[model samples]
Target: MPGTIAFVGDSLTAAGRWDEWLPEFTVSNHAAGGATTADVLAEVDVVLANRPDAYVLLIGTNDLAWRKSVEHVVRNVESILATVHKHEPSTRMLVQSVLPREPEFAASIRDINRHLWQYSSTVRAQFLDLWPVLADENGALSPVHSEDGLHLTAAGYELWLDALRPAIERLFAVPTTTTPIDVLSDAISVSGLR
Candidate 1:
């Protein structure tokens, strides 16, 4: 069966050619350049309205560049996940870590990724840590992958695609099943979303 997937985030996601990269699925790119986590949170309903079988989120780097606190970004992301899970409990979700950038922002980015990983688990969303593949020894975005230290090069996108494709396949391979309403409600409550 063909599945629909929505990509939501900032420029990194906006720049992807998902249709070409993953042609088996219907792809919707809701990402925009310069977007922050707050931006995605604001328009989450629009993304949800697509009713995709799965969602791929790659946000938060822009927020870091704008100097937003790590907690602020994490909270906004948590709200986004809670909102999606509330509306589409059966949908699969993959939250990619904020990619490495300038060295100065590495620590904060790592902090946000850690929170995202933990929170994604709580919400039953899979988290992809891009650091191992995209970060240099100094923990900055690798120059081979990005010339501007912010945006990715062709090589970077290829690496990203390599990491992402298998995860999506795994998501698709799983048979879809409905969670009982009581269990779903409990998960939402335990997730700390109001």
Candidate 2:
């Protein structure tokens, strides 16, 4: 099998079907109904125990719901990054941009995404922009992608996959073969990273 990857997030990441969408990687998601960075940190030990080769963080929607400032959320994210550094130092990172919420919260969502993009550069973390995938022309969640006007429906997750696949493929292709080569390792080694 390919290296294990863990996804830490809230409801959207836990939407009961990401595995069906992307089966190429071994995905272990630790997501709850309303998880925040704080909640994720609390359970990271369990996730780290898996010796994940990478972590895909899709949190912050709950923080946004709580009306937390972008800086505060980034601080939480930074703390998670530090945790990853200590435990999974060799792990690559992929951070999905916080999706836009309701129209009233659009500014805050934009603010969070701006900081996410800026800070993603600072940390060499790959940033996946959900804004394009989730937002309508007016910058709220596109009705097509969301059922609750916030969380994803099947179509929303499809949008997520469309945006996410390129990055995930790129991650899998990279030579993170940091172990005794197994059969799965050899398969990737021969194919080369696209």
Number of the predicted model whose TM-score against the real structure is largest: 1
lDDT of 1 by residue, 18-133 (tens): 99988889999999999998999999899888788998999998888788999999999999998887777778889999999999998999999999999997777888889898
TM-score, every prediction: 0.91, 0.84
Clash list (residue pairs), candidate 2: none
Count steric clashes of candidate 1: 0
Deviation (Å) of 50 in candidate 1: 1.3
What is candidate 2's lDDT per residue for 114-193, written digit by digit as tens? 88777774544678888876898777887778767888878887778888888877766655423332454578878994
Which regions of candidate 1 fall more than 4 Å away from where they truly are? 175-194
Where does candidate 2 have its weakest 10-residue lDDT segment? 175-184
Residue 157 alpha-carbon offset, candidate 1, angstroms? 0.4
C-alpha RMSD of candidate 2: 8.1
- Model 1 poorest ten-residue lDDT run: 173-182
Name the runs in model 2 displaced over 4 angstroms: 175-194
RMSD of each: 4.0, 8.1
Q: Per-model C-alpha lDDT, please?
A: 0.89, 0.77
